[model samples]
Target chain A: MSKPTAGIFGLTGCAGDQLVILNCEDELLDLVNLLDLRDFLMATSANDTRCSLDVAFVEGAVMSRRDEETLERIRQRSRFLVAIGACAVWGGVAAQESNGNHAALLEDVYGPLGRQYDAIPARALHELVKVDLNITGCPIEKSQILAAIANLLQGDPPLLPQYAVCAECRMRENNCLLIEKGSVCCGPLTAAGCEARCPALRIPCIGCRGPADDVNTASAWAMFEEKGYTRADVDRKLRTFAPKGGRA
Target chain B: MSTTIRIDHLARVEGHGGVTVEMEGGAVRGVQFDVFEGARLLEGLVKGRSYEDISPVLSSICAICSVAHSLTSLKATENAFGVEVSPQTEALRDLLSLGESIESHALHLFFLAIPDYLNYPSAVALAADNLPAVQLGLRLKKLGNTIQETVGGRAVHPVNAVLGGFGRVPGFDQLAELRAALAGAAADCETMLEIVAGLPAASFFRAGIAFGALVSPREYGYYAGEEVTMALDGESETIPAPEYKRFTNERAVPHSHAKHSTYNGRPYMVGSLARLVVNRARLGERGLAAMKRLGLRFPPDNPTDNNKAQAVELVNDVDRALRIVESLLEHGLKDEPPVPVAPRAGAGTGITEAPRGILIHSYVYDEAGRLTAADVITPTAINAASIEDHLRRAAENAAPGEEAALTRAFEMIVRAYDPCISCSVHVVRRGHDG
Candidate 1:
């Protein structure tokens, strides 16, 4: 049997998710051996853009026409397309509430010349294409990325934790920063795979992993408001990293 | 015959960028290092957002150097609010920055550029033959990530570090662990320098370009510098960070998403090359020894030598990191809460030497602490014109009809700079006075 063909592509974000794949310093050599890696521009100069891929890990949001074209080409050639990180699954930080004046924003950076780039409002991968799996994180956590790859390699659909970050925070025996400290934490609304990284350090969750499954949106909002945060503040925190539908 | 040599989708570098060199009648007419990455108007995105949210978003500009962006953003915000952090905070931030520089340089020299020098398609191919080299690179890279994870919370986008100080400072044990790691890696760092010195010279050298980097009146440092020093053909000028616009005259250009920058009407260089050129005198004992052993001359004209410069800096970074760790451990750890911030209407600029080069973050906040205006100048943007100049010379020197060789040469030239296209295209407009 031939090894599974894999290609990791980045679109229009920090390239952090892809860097996470590289940060798998120990597993990287083994990963390349297990997968018939073809296209990973960030990692290699020898890339085959036309090669059919068994698994395509795509990061970054579709923030431009060029990105859309790149995604379409990759999607066309790949059997399993996994959206990695908050940027590809959700709109990430680039998709913040500043879309109303995106035109003005572009102009502000490039003067009138920004019009030539023909940039679109940042949108997640699923918004434009069919995503088979979604691994969410600001930069996808190392364990989660490795696990997803291992599962996919075995022809098993990767199982993502559907629990909220608060559950993991509880598991870590960390005090609830939201309730105890009255910080503007988003643990109740966030997906659990990061081991509650920020809150573990007494910092509030910025919700980089998008939304949790079966989360009570109404109660989450009420809890935040009860902790002295206004509805606007809660909404702002939610929109910071939550996917499009995850926002209130 | 005139031909346009386009290496679209430049590989083995961070983000999306390509090189387009136009050859006309054997003379290189022009060259454009096009950044195909999408315009992430991060400055615009953070317009009405609170000050705290700005760095988190902007830091995502480049994952490889996220710590640099985060620290610079925090400094800019801190400067704006007139916040003064404790020495511990300053020391820890410096340690984190050095960690990033070491990691970035290691990644570039081994995984990225070494493949080119060794004539391999990628590190994966190189690893098939040279496993130990690849393993050493991984160890060095992991060391970087560990420091970042320990200090900033996560390796990529840090969460614990905020405006005034860290949300949770690493304990004495954590600092000691870093020191032990540095001590263990001392021999490895020397081995790294040897590996760097072994590579065949890239031979892409020229003079007349300006070199710029953040300079400290104190020690050779990144975060310690409030002023920038630019040297061209032996003459140098030190400009305050607030007047960065004078040096980084950024403007938009056709055929590239990122803008081009200039100093004194000439393309200027930054990054490890510029850092070494500007601060060679202030190098620590280890760095000076490494330079002497490596036989590196001052004000190297070759961009490819940047990799070697990075290797030398890697040793220095480790040396500096160990000292910082020792200082922290000696002083004992303090669990200080983030300093209280009261935002007022004012504008401030934070400048630091990111791994790739100088990174600047400037912002204006209203009385409510909401950002009113912003401007960011990444090192890649600053090096854009300088990159083109090198590409033009490389193309001019290339044998006609050897498109493959020319393309390879151009790619090597660009990659040597380790241009982070993701970071460069964030913002260009510099005159955003609040």
Candidate 2:
């Protein structure tokens, strides 16, 4: 059987998630051999953007018309399309101010020069096109990505935990940062699979993984309020990565 | 006859950008380095957010240089609030920056820039014939990540270093392990130096250029000092960091998303070459020795020599990291809490040498500690004009109608700087631009 071709792409966020794949020092060479890596622009200059692929892993949010067009093309070409970070899964931090006037923001930053480039408000991959799977994190965890690749190669669907990050924190025996330290944490609302990395180090979880399945955002906000966080703080924390809809 | 050379999607660089070189009748008409990545409005988003939230928010600017952004934001915030951290904390921050330098420089020199020299399309292709070199690059990168993960909690967007100090210090055992790794990596640095030296010399568009970098009186500046040293026209001057606005004179351009930066009305260079030129005397024994082995001299006029300068910095980073780890071991790692901050209305600037070059993050806060304004100038933006200048020169000198040669020349010049488009696109707000 011929090797399955795979492509990696970035749209409109920090190309950190793609860098995460490169960061897998131990498995990178072997992974390249296992699958026919086709298009990874950050790693190589020689790439075929037009080729069909068995799997396509894309990072970043669709923050412009060009990005949407790119994602649509990738979705059509690949049999399985995986959104590989919070940016692709939930628009990431770039979408935090989607409600604001993008033109004004651009003008504020670039003045008249901002009009030269066209951009739309940032949105997630699922909102624009079909996404077969999501590997969640601000920068997706390397182990989770490796596991997903393994599962896919074995002809099994990639499994991702739908539970809140709190479950993983408890399993790791990390103290409840919200209750114990009075720090505002979103572990109860964030997706699991990161092993509660931030909370383990005494830093509160900032919800870089986006919301968990059926999370009670209102209750989470109430809990933060009980911990002496202001309403603005709760709203800011929730909206930081994946803000609700607004047009550009 | 008019010929246009366009790279719609420039590869091997961070984020998204492209280049276009237009020539009319064999004379170069124009060269534009364009960043089409959608504006994230990072500066505008940070507005009204509390001071404490700025670092984490801005750290998203670039994953590879997250520590640089985090550290610089923290420094600016602390400076605004009149907070001072312990010397140990400062040393740890410096070590973290050095780790970033080692990893970033290794990745660029081996994976991105070396392929151009060997006439290969990519490092993966180069690896088939030369596995050891690729392995060595990976080893160095892994070591850098290990240091960042151990000290800052995670490799990308570190969560440990916060406010005025780290949330938790690495244990003695961890520091010793890192020290041991650094000591072992010395030979790898030598090998890297030899590899870079073996590559054919690049002499595309050599020009006398002004170089900018931070200057430290105490040591080689990475996470230290508030003064900048500028080398222009064979003369040097030291200016306060706050006076950067006076010299940088950042302005927006229509053809690109990133703002163009100029020093004294002309584009200047920054990054490894700039740092090395400005602070060559402060290089430790290993760093100086690596420079000698690489046959590099100060004030290199060719931008392509930045690759050699980065190789030298790899040695400096490892040597400095080893010294820092040993000192921490000797003093016994202290678990000190972050310095207390009293919120007040003020503005401050944080400048540091990111792996690519000097990165500046300046912010203004209201009395309630909410961010009122921000201006971030990335090294790539500072080098954008200089890259174009080189591209134009390369295009003008290329054999007429030799499109492939011109493209190769342009790519080499741009890649030599290792520009990070993600970091560079953060808009700078000059007076009333908002």
Candidate 3:
């Protein structure tokens, strides 16, 4: 059987997720052997931007008309379109102030020339087109991306962690950061698969991975409030990566 | 007759940008490098966020050099509040920046730029023939990531390097392992130097260009610097970092979303080449030996020599990082608490050299520590005008009908700078275009 062809792309956010794919040092050579890696522009000077693929993994949010058009074209060509990181899954950090005045914002950044490019509010891939799977994180975990690819190769849906990051913390026997240090951790609401990395390092989880299934947002908010955080603080933490109304 | 050459999507470089070369009557009419990536308005988003939230938010500017952003932001915030970090913390932060420098140079030289020379479409295709070089590149890159992951927590957008100090320091065993890794990679580092030096030299865009870089009084500076040294008109001048706006008269252009920056009203280069040109005397013994072996010299005129400069820097950074690790181990690791900061109303400027070039982050805070204003000048934005200048010259020299050759030349010049468009576009100032 022929190898499954894959194309990796970036949209609006930092190219962290795609960089994470390249960060797979031990597996990168094997990955190229396993798949017909077609269009990774960041890693190769040669690319077929219009090539068809069995799987397409896209990072970053749809923030411009060009981004929307590119996502649509890729969606039409690929059998499976996977949203690779927080950006594609939930609009990422670039969408944090999506409701702000874009024209004024552009003018502020680019002065009079800001009016040159056409831009719209950033949106997730699933909001504009179909997303077969989402491997979530500010920068997606290397192992999860590899796992997702393996599952796709087997003609099966990739298995994603459905529980909150707190579960993984408990399994790792890490002390509860919120309870022990009174730090406002988002572990109770954030998705697992980061191996509770931040909490292990004694830093509270800022929820870069987005919310997990059955996330008790109200309880999480109350927990923050009880810990002396204001409503605004709670809102800001939750909405930093995956803002409210991000879902399609 | 008139003809125009367009590269709709420039591949291999970070972020979205393109080039359009217009020729009329066999002379280059005009050239424009357009950055069509959506404006993220990072400066606007950073407003109202507290000093503590600044680094993490700004860290998202570019994943490739998140450490640079986060550290520079921390430095600015610390400056605002008058916080002093421990010597250990400073050493660790320097190591983190070195790690990023190594990773970025390897990725750019091996993965991005080398393919153009090998006549291959991508590094993966080139890898089939040059497996050892590719493997060595990855190994070197991994070492850098390991340093970051060990010190800052994760590889990208680190969580440990906070406002005052790290959230947690690495263990003795971890530092030992990293030291051993750097030691093991010395021979591979030499191999990389040879590989880059062996590539064909690019001489198209080498005339009448000035260079800018951050210079420290102490060592081959990446993290510690308060003054910038610029080589202009066959001489150099040192200016304080806070006065960068005077040198970097940033303004917008119609063709690109990213702002164009000029020093003393002239386009100047930055990054490894600029740093090497301005501070070649600071090269350590290992770095000096490598330069001697490769027959590389200072004040290089060609921008493509930036690749060779990065190879030289890779050796310097590894050697410097090794010495730092040894010093820490010699003095013994300490889990010193971060210096407490009391927020005050003041403006502070922090500057550091990202792997590409000098990066500056300046901020103003209200008495409550809420950010009222923010400005960032990335190396790429500063180099944009220089890139255009080079492209215009290269296009003018191109044969009348050779579109492919012109496109190749344009791409080579742009890639030499290793511009991160995402970081460059983060600059937003609230004022009318003057």
- For model 2, the docking class works out as medium
Q: Which 10-residue window of candidate 2 chain B scores lowest in summed lDDT? A: B425-434
User: lDDT tens digits, residues B1-434, model 3?
Assistant: 79887777778888877777788977888777766666777887888887877898899989998999999999988987888889899999999999889888888888888888767778888889999989999999998898889888989998889978888888899999999998998999988988887887676755777899999567885898889988877888898978888768876655544466887778899999898887778989998887787666555767787888888899999999999999998999988767778899999999999999989999999999999999988888888888888888887766778877777888888888898877776442111111
| Interface RMSD values for all candidates | 4.7, 4.6, 4.3
TM-score of 1: 0.97
TM-score to true structure, per model = 0.97, 0.96, 0.96
The sequence of per-residue lDDT tens digits that candidate 3 reaches over residues A1-248 is 99999999998889999999989999999999999988888787667778799999999999877788889999999998999999899988778775667777766666666665666677899998989898999899998999989888888888989889999999989888887888878899899999999888778898899989867778877887788889777668878889843345
Q: List the DockQ of the predictions in order.
A: 0.63, 0.56, 0.57
Better of 1 and 3 by DockQ: 1
After superposition on all C-alphas, the RMSD of every candidate to the true structure, in Å, is: 3.1, 3.0, 2.6
lDDT (Cα, tens digit) per residue for candidate 1, span B319-344: 98888888788878889988898899
Chain A TM-score by candidate, in order? 0.96, 0.93, 0.94
For model 3, fnat equals 0.72
